[model samples]
Target: MDFFNILILAIVQGAAELLPVSSSAHVIVAEKLMGLDPTSPEMTMLLVMLHTGTMFAVIVYFWQAWRDTYFSSGHAFRSNARLIVVATAATGVVGLLLLKLIKHLVAGNDPGFEIEHLFANAKLMAAALAAAGVLIIASSRLPERANGALNLRTAAWVGAVQGLCLPFRGFSRSGATISTALALGSSRRRAEEFSFALAVVLTPAVIVKEAFRLYQSHALTVAKNGTSLLQLVGPSLVGMLLSFVAGLLALRWLSRWLEQGRWHFFGAYCLVAAVVVLLVG
Candidate 1:
């Protein structure tokens, strides 16, 4: 990949990743437009690195808020920790089951087929984007419950919604999880915080998984091209740095819109984006 393409992808990933919009959808569309293969091992690795950049951005942006809330007291810390664990566990179970089911249905006896093979399907991506948009809009309209608090039930719900996002490229994980939290009666602030907290946990695992996949799939490519693993991933490192900066700006924008009761605007944008993707793709 060239520097210009990497830069463009970094910006797109950074911006959309933090917002309710599906970053994967935008990045994949951008890749297709640029004549890049979204399902390629190298591209998938770069995508994961781009996510790593935004994950750091989330940590930097939310550090103080997390400190004041999750770490406020010993009891608070423990309680929040348990909630995170439960949510993560739920996500793992549901995501794995969905992956298994998908592989069985789609690949059958093809042991070599991986989920990434479906990443470039435009129709699937568009439909998932539209679905996520509708969910976000509907959840935003739900009446807020007084004394809405983050509980085990709410966390599990959010996690399950997140799991639904795993197999579908255009189903925004943050959007689905945050909307689920809101619909379950949690405050916007709490939903935002918890959604990102789950992201921070989820991102590293994804990075590791993609890294392994890249190595497994691209070993022959690397040998043929006389490139080391470091050489292959070096460009992604630069893209990650650029994405980190963009992600910070995006996080601020998302926070402002979410706090100002304009959360549904993102959903509206997703709906429009879905149409555009279907046309262009």
Candidate 2:
């Protein structure tokens, strides 16, 4: 990819990663529109970097809240910490199982671009986006409640929804988890905060997974493609920096908009985006 293409993709990844919109969907669409191959190892590496960048953004934005909620000595803080742990564990279990299922169905027999049913599959993405939109819109309609005071059952449901998002690129993890939490009677701010905290907790595993994949790809490449793996490092770092800056802004905007109950606007936007993608694809 050229500099301009990489710049655009980085911006898209950074901005979309924090929104209730799926960064994966936005990045894939950007790759298609830019005539870039989504299946390239370079592209995959860049994506990992972008994800890491947004992960950092989440950490920076929520540092204070996490300290207050998880590190405080108060009884309420301890209880909230336990609840977050339970929810995070649930999310991990659900996400792993769903990812395994997708792997078996798509990447099991034939692990190639054809097997990449999760990428650039407009129909699937559109449907996933619509589902997420509905959930978020519905959550926005519910009565507001206190932040960070979730019960176990509600936390489990949110975690389960997060797991479902693992296999679908258009299904935003943050959107699903936050919406599920809200639907389960958690307040909007609390849902969003917890969702981000979970992200901070889980991001390292994802980064490690991608790093292992990148290593395997390097060691097992065929003697046909005359590309150097090292070339991706610069682009990946650049993309990561860009994504961090953009993601911070997006997170702030999303938090403000969600608190004001303006999330239906995103739902409408997703509906329109789905229609456009369906027609284009």
Every candidate's CA RMSD:
1.5, 2.6
Candidate 2 residue-wise lDDT at 66? 74
lDDT of 1 by residue, 195-273 (tens): 9999999999888988887887688777677656776588899889989999999999988988788889989988999
Instruction: Give the CA lDDT, 0 to 100, for residue 262 in model 1.
Output: 87
Instruction: Please report, as a residue range, the 10-residue window in candidate 2 with the lowest summed lDDT.
Output: 109-118
Q: RMSD to the native, candidate 2?
A: 2.6
| lDDT of every predicted structure (CA atoms) | 0.89, 0.80
Error of 1 at 192 (Å): 0.3
Query: What TM-score does structure 2 among the candidates reach?
Result: 0.90
- Candidate that scores best on TM-score: 1
